[model samples]
Target: MPDITHEEWLRRAESWKVSGAHHIDGADEPGGGATFTVVSPRDGRVLAEVADGGTAEVDAAVAAARRAFDTGPWPRLAPAERGRVLLRIADLLEERREELALTVSLEMGKPVTEAYAIELRAVIGTFRWYGHLADKLTDESPHTPQDALALVTREATGVVGAVVPWNFPLTLAGWKVAPALAAGCTVVLKPSENSPLSALLLGRIATEAGLPPGALNVVAGNGPVAGRALGLHPDVDVLAFTGSTAVGRHFLHYAADSNLKRVWLELGGKSPNIILPDAPDLAKAAATAAWGIFFNQGEMCTAPSRLLVHSSVAEQVTDAIVARADALRVGDPLDPATEMGALVSAGHLGRVLDHVGTGLDEGARLRAGGERTLTGTGGSYLRPTVFDRVAPGMRLSREEIFGPVLSVLTFDDLDEAVALANATEYGLAAGLWTSDLSTAHRVSRALKAGTVWVNCYEEGDLSVPFGGMKQSGNGRDKSVHALEKYTELKTTWIQL
Candidate 1:
């Protein structure tokens, strides 16, 4: 499909409707409980009244997933057959590409263009990649005595409880759900209360693509209710979560307090992007620094919120970034020309603004774009903000702001640069822009983040594993390695 005009996108948004009930047993369930109003940050309008799933709803969903895993055909099917089903699901998602994109953009305040290109692309690619990889996996057999045979194989770990955040709802859910389903495990997905529409849509697509009843379920509610129940459920063999570091810790505690199920976390980050004086393209590095923090309104876990620049070129790089930030168009998300959209919600915007205030009070120089904007529309909009001459010890430099807020810190040498970059509690991702191969290799190795980009920020492929170290949480997402999280190894010995 071609790119539509902004007016066309607005027309589609007016006509769009969302699914608001919990999906269980291949159908939508009203849950017979109270509902919560979901407000769009794009225009501060009430989108829908989503079912507020609680422990009872969690129980039903988990029970459905448990039945599917224990006695259903989903787990008993051949790997190749299951692979075909996943491929069909991918095709179905592609078929509803426009609809799904609209749902995501309306629910989460992402640009319609980006929701179509980046978000849907990732979701579709994840399922398609895992589908192709499902049957190609192999088991292992070890050498043994002449009269004996030994075989080691992978088995599905049973029901998976996936709790994903709202920033990139469909993409993050797809990262967990596609791999778990590909590994022959049933799933009970609990999306964030702020953005559950797209996830409910995903559940319907899965059932329509020939998945058996009870194989995949979606429950939408607040974190303390449905998410807590899923984390503490004894029947779920594994729980995969992507959210804040504090929430990630709660899942670990829930695992220990309940069934000791395997818990995999992909948590928060305050990643650093370093620019050396010898960068191959200083202008490009500065532009990317602006894009890195401003993209998705900086609600990304791996957003380069901190920019560490060499002292000699700090002024030049900082000025370039400020210019780019000033040039960014902050407006309606449906407009294809708008580079930055609204924050996810009013509460989230308040939190981010508080952090901005703290930064100013802590003595960081506000370079450009530090206040709220577009108030006439009643949308949760903020300017692309940048703070220069940030000290290493400041709160803005250490905490994961998780917004379109950038902190610029200067370093005199390579040692100080690396030390400053590694100072934060997060180590999810980092970026470096340099021309020298030796410096690139040295800095990339020394950076403590899980993924380090030499000249790019947030560029990734399904072939590489993505996760974090330290307080950023644990385990891997994407690639074949992700399947390991949903499967267990079993060894069988035969004697002749």
Candidate 2:
């Protein structure tokens, strides 16, 4: 496909206007609360006026989900029948690919081309993969010495509350909703207030795909109000959330206080990307490191923000990465040619800037692109930032700065590199760049992260599990492990 110009991208975004306040019980209506503007991060243009839902609305949504799961046909439907509905939703997403991508780009400020190619496509693929796997989930039979019959069954965990971040709204929503629905559970989703349009649109698609009323509901609201209510609701059986580590801890506390509902959180990260001197193709390693940190404006939880370079080629790798970061295009997200887009909102941009200031105060050298704003851009734009000579103890190296900032740290040997990488409290994800078979195997085993990519960065597939360890939060989001989170296994024995 040819690259889309900025003007064309804007036009495409303007053309996608499926408006409503909320989608509850398989229908759309203006929410009870006042309307809020969903602005374009490219130019601060008013993309749409979305309904800002609150506690009452959340209660109603949860009630609807509970009613659907209790008395509706969704949970009673055969696994194959439920799979058909999910497959239909995936097909509908593909049919409206352009609109979905445009809405995502406008809401979250990701490059339009990348949003279409990566985010939307991945969402569709996730639905299809889980849909096919639904039928394969079955109960087990056991043999015993006694004259008795035994069976182990997997049952849906009833109502689920899914709260997704603005970084990858649709894709993350799919991560939570697809498996829940496939496992015969009903879901009420709360999208981030900064970017709720795409998820609302997805709710409409779910209805069109013939999902039962209240099986999938979209409630758009802030974290303090709607998100807190979802986590604390007694009726919600499971809470699946993806956001900052601070908020994840709060959700865990809320779950503990409110009915002890199962909470699955995929939270923050300062993931490390280690590059040993023996790695073949230094240029490729440097480019991958740059993309790993700068992709999606570094808003991803799995983004490799820490670069650990061997002392022998630390200077060489840092120089190459700096050059690549400098070359990244930071402009209107609607422009297909653009590589980086604005942060999700003005407040987030300010927080990212504050982290840059903290880095400078910690005495780290700002090697390139620090505290620079895009000229003539109306949105919350920040230039790609790189810090060199950063020690592991520095705030910038330890904290999860969810922006386009890369911190380069040098290590004298492989053992030190592994120690520095695992020093942080977080263990979401990490990367290694090397060609030596023994070194790669040794380092991959030593890393404390949940997912380790050797010679690659941020590469994910639907078949593999995705989640975090330590302070990054628990419970897998993708793969068959996700199904386990959404289900409960029961064992029964009977005398023959």
Candidate 3:
């Protein structure tokens, strides 16, 4: 497909009619009297009046899911039959990729190109991948004496409640929903209030792909209302969430307070990207570091926000990164030429600016981009910021700002670099650039992170698992292991 012009994208945006309602039982319904205004970060324009769901809507969605799980054909169908539905969903998503990508770009400030190329690509691939594997899974049988036979089987764990954040709304939801559905579990998905339009569309698409009436439902509301309700729902057998660590803790508490449903969380990160003097290519490492921090406007859970470089190469790498940051084009999300788009919201932009202020107050040198940009456009825009001479104890290094902000800290030796990278409470991901084979092996093993990228950043495949450790959260998101979250093992013993 050829790339569309920016004017063409703007024309399409003008005609795009967005829906704002709770998707339940294969239909759209109005929420309880209240509504929240969704403002696009691209130009701070009001996009739609979304239903503000609460306990009642959550209960309805959960009940629908429960009924589907207990009595509907979705759970009872043969594994191969279920796989066909998932494959159909993937095809449907492909047919409507333009509509979905436009919706995500308008709702969350992601560049339309990225929304098409990266986000939709991931969503389609996930459903297709899980669909292909659905019928391939096999149950286990143990050897026993002739008098007795034992069989162990995997059963769908009833209803699944998935709560995803604003960034990468569709992709993150797919990570949890596709596998759960493939495992034969009905789902009640709660998308963050900031980005709900796309999820609502996805729910409609799933129904068109021939899912049972209640196989998938999407409720849009704030974390305290719909999210909390899903977490505390008694009938939900499993809960999967992707968001902040602070919210992850709330779900854990809600589980303890309710039926103790199995909860899987993929939370925050303050990942470090290290560059050594003996790196294979200093310029390439510097460029990747810039891309790592600035991608998606730096609103990613696995974003490499910390840059730890050996003292011998720190200046060259930092200077290269600053040059790249300055050259990035931040503008309208619908524009194809935009390399960086607006922040998610005005409030988030303010929060990021506050962190920049804190870094300056704490004595870190602001080498580039310390102020707000493009204020006349009424959009939430910030220049990509870089802070050098940062100490390990600084808040800029320790906490997740979740924006296009980078903190560069210099280390003298391999041990010091590894120590700095492992100092964070969040252990979601890390990246190191080195040419020495022995050093790469030793350092990769020493880093306390779920994924360590050697000489690369954010490169991954669907076959491998992705998750976090320590304060970042627990449980994997991708791969066949994700099925473990939505299914349970059952043992049956027969005596002849």
lDDT of 2 at 134: 83
How many pairs collide in each candidate, listed in order?
0, 0, 0
User: Per-residue lDDT tens digits of candidate 2, residues 143-220?
Assistant: 876788899999999999999999999999999999999999999999998889889989999999999999999998
TM-score of each: 0.99, 0.98, 0.99
The collision pairs in model 3 are none
What is the alpha-carbon lDDT of model 2 when measured against the actual structure?
Answer: 0.89
Query: What does candidate 1 score on TM?
Result: 0.99
TM-score attained by model 3: 0.99
Summarize candidate 1's per-residue lDDT along 1-496 as a digit string, tens digits. Answer: 4479999989998888987999998999999678999999999999999999999999999999999999999999988988899899999999999888888888889898899899999999999999999899999999999999999999999999999999999999999999999999999999999999999999999999999988899999999889999999999999999999999999999999999999999999999999999999999999999999999999999999999999999999999999999999999999989889999999999999999999999999999988999999888999999999799889999888889999999999999999999998999999999999999999999999999999888897999999999999888999999999999999999997
Clashes of 2: 0
Q: List the global CA lDDT of all models.
A: 0.93, 0.89, 0.94
Candidate 1 local Cα displacement, residue 210, angstroms:
0.8
Stretches of candidate 2 exceeding 4 Å from the true structure: 1-4
Task: Report the alpha-carbon TM-score of model 2 versus the true structure.
Answer: 0.98
Clashing residue pairs in candidate 1, if any? none
